[model samples]
Target: MADIKVIIPAYNEVDSIAHVVNELPKSVSEVIVVNNNSSDNTVKNAETAGATVITELRKGYGYACLKGLEYIASKSKQPDIIVFIDGDYSDYPEELDNVVAPILEDDIDFVVGARRKNLREEGSMTPQQVFGNWLATFLMRLFFGAKFTDLGPFRAIKYDKLKELNMEDKTYGWTVEMQLKILKKKMTYTEVPVRYKRRIGISKVSGTVKGSIFAGIKILGWIFKYSIK
Candidate 1:
């Protein structure tokens, strides 16, 4: 079995952080939750749930994720695979094994947990989120001949391949950046359908107008930026 590590970026998700931590499949060697300047009990709850909680004072999704990567890079024993999941408990953390299965069994370089509509609970994704996912993926298909369906947060990637991508997004462009780089490098990738449900608290991105606009702009910016390259 591959040594798998999970990274979860959380900001004021105290209501759902513990559930996300405890429900993770024991197959993962460690769960690291990067608390992105949360004012709630996120850190304490994540610790109680048996996750190695780290604080990232920076306030961006990518910043928190990069902090988790930094912590992993410092460890003497490196993981074989790294998985990124949200701390909102919207994704079924118990399905982690299924998410990483492609990478472990098929030797795929990267995997994204696709939140297929049929598998997703109604209202799990807001209108803007749905449209944005569609538009971004549509653009990817048109410009890059990519096959991605959803930009869902639950994902897994080979540690080495992840490092090779040289991820630098410090905000909403993180997911799209990874996908674009994978496509650019011609790396093998696949998506696994995963069940999804409404998040415990309101979303930091899709729940608000400002977040939605910024995220959309960032995602689209990454795609277009790569298209011209």
Candidate 2:
């Protein structure tokens, strides 16, 4: 069986973290939850749910993910696939098998869990978030001839291929950065439609004006920078 590992970057996701940890498919060998300076019981809850939790004081989605990668690196046996999913229960964790299917069964280097509009719960995504996803994807198609529909956080990539990308984004640009790099490198990738719903708690990004603005800026900045490159 191919070994698979999952990385979840959490902030104050106390209510949702345990559900995300416990709902993962059994195919996953380990679930690494990186607590991104959560002030809640995220760590305790994750531990109680039988997850390997770690602390990443640096407060960024990329920082928490990188911390999880560092932990996996220290392990004697590395996973064949690395899955990245939000700590929020908005994403259906049981579909992790679907997310990694392309890589495992088709030899694709990466797989994105695309949240199609029809599959998403109404009000699950903010108006700005929907517009942002549309604009970003439109730009990607214009500049890179990419076919990505959504920059969904639930995605999977091969371990070796992931290392080759040398991802360095430290904030909201993480998802777009990965897609851009995949395009730049001409890597084999695909998207699998996945169901989505409102999270257990308010989103730290889309729920706040400042968070949404910064995230939009970061995402656009990366796209423009890569387009010029």
Could you estimate the TM-score for every candidate?
0.99, 0.99
| RMSD (Å) of each candidate, 1 decimal | 0.6, 0.7
Clashes of 1: 0
Question: How would you encode candidate 1's per-residue C-alpha lDDT over 167-224 as one tens digit per residue?
Answer: 9999999999999999999999999999999999999999999999999999999999
Best candidate, lDDT-wise?
Answer: 1
lDDT of 2 by residue, 33-139 (tens): 99999999999999999999999998999999899999999999989999999988999999999898888789999999999999999999999999999999999
Worst 10 residues of 2 by lDDT: 97-106
Q: Report the lDDT of model 2 for residue 79.
A: 90
Q: How many residue pairs clash in each candidate at the backbone level?
A: 0, 0
